[model samples]
Target: MKTRTITGVFFIIVMLASLLTGHYSFGAFYLLLGLFCQFEFYGLIKKSGYQPNYVAGLINGALIYIAFAYTANTHIVQPVLFLIPVTLSAVFIQELFKKSTTPFQNIAFTILGLMFTVMPFTFFHAMAYVNGDFNFHLPLGFFVMLWSNDTGAYLTGRAFGRTKLFERHSPKKTVEGFFGGLLIAALAGYILSIYYTEIEWKQWISMAILISCFGTLGDLVESMFKRSINVKDSGGILPGHGGLLDRFDGLLIAAPIVYSYLYFMAT
Candidate 1:
């Protein structure tokens, strides 16, 4: 318990620092984070008796993230975007020579790794520069609400949780906890509106609803991934937290949706 609390605090501090530092740090930090998460995902897939093309996947992940980050900042897609398909194509071509029995399975997992981890992070990194420049407020607000929801759900579920939310994926989650999380996230959004006036309060609350709903879904999805593999945690890199993926699973799914909302609103 003590180790978990300490590690949690350190993790939050590092994440906040990465965002608050500047655009370079923000981009660099998340780029590396996205890669690490992808690597971790590949590792897990290997444990399930499949081999994903790590080289191709990582290259593609980096290219896609950089391409999106560049476009988000300048509003002009770079020629580097061209490298994505080329790298992706290499995944299929590389599998042809491996002589593996499940070549298509290898190919599928390779691409799935990109879709599961890289694409969402590309959207997330782009979110920082959504308004034609880097601004941490929106991304920061996202973390705040996400954390609020996680904390609220945990507390509420412990106190009054009677019905399981999804017994198949996550038996511990309850419907009551879900609503409690939504309410707390909404309150956090209202508070964010008072301080970060880039968007309306209602918009912030709406975003909170999205994060709460999708963040929970993300957690369940990761849980399902683990249960399928008969694992308890994603990885043990963090002493208390399971892995980078475990920590940011909520962000993984929520980032894309929130980015879309903000992008449409901005345009």
Candidate 2:
């Protein structure tokens, strides 16, 4: 328990520091995070006895993240997006050199890793740059709402949990706890809307609901994967947190959907 709390605190500090520091740190931090998540995903896939093209997947993921980060900061939509396909094609081309048997499956998992981890992160990190600058409100508010949901769910579940939310995938989750988390997240969103002022309070509340709902689904999805593999945690990097994926699973599912909402609202 102590180790978990300490690691959690350390992660929060680093995340906030990097986010608030400036664009460089923010970009660098998420870029590194994206890589780690991708690496971890590929590692998990490898354990399943499928030989994924590790180098190709890692390189392509880095390319996708860096390209998005570059375009986000400068607010310049350049030809770089085009280059992603060029690198992605390299993934297939490089597979020919490998002596592995399941070339197509390898390529598929490689791409899946990029889609599952890199894409959402790109959208999530880009949220802070909609105003042509590093506005902390969107990203910071997201974390607040997400953390609120997690904390609320745990407490509420412990206190009044009865009905199973998704027992097959995640046996511990309860329907009562899920609603409690949503309520808490909504409250946090309302407060954040007041302080951030970038998004209306109503929209912020909606965003919180989305975060809670989709985030829970995301957790279920990860749980499903872990269960299929007969594993408890993704990795041991975070001590009490299980793994980075265990921590960001909700963000993985929420970020892209939330980005779409914000985009339409802004448009």
**How many clashes in each structure?**
0, 0
**Candidate No. with top lDDT:** 1
- lDDT (C-alpha) at residue 257 in model 2: 85
Best by TM-score: 1
Cα displacement (angstroms), candidate 1, residue 194, comes to 0.5
Residue 59 lDDT, candidate 2, scale 0-100: 85
Please give me the total number of clashing residue pairs in predicted model 1: 0
Q: Over the stretch 1-267, how does candidate 1's per-residue lDDT look in tens digits? A: 999999999988988999999998888988999999999999999999998999999999888888988888898979998877778899999987897888999999989888889888888888777766788998999999999999999999999999999999999999999999999999999999999888899989999999999999999999999999999988999998889899999987898999899889743
Superposing all C-alpha atoms, what RMSD in Å does each candidate have to the true structure? 1.0, 1.2
Candidate 2 ranges with C-alpha deviation above 4 Å: none
- Scored by Cα lDDT, where does model 2 land? 0.89
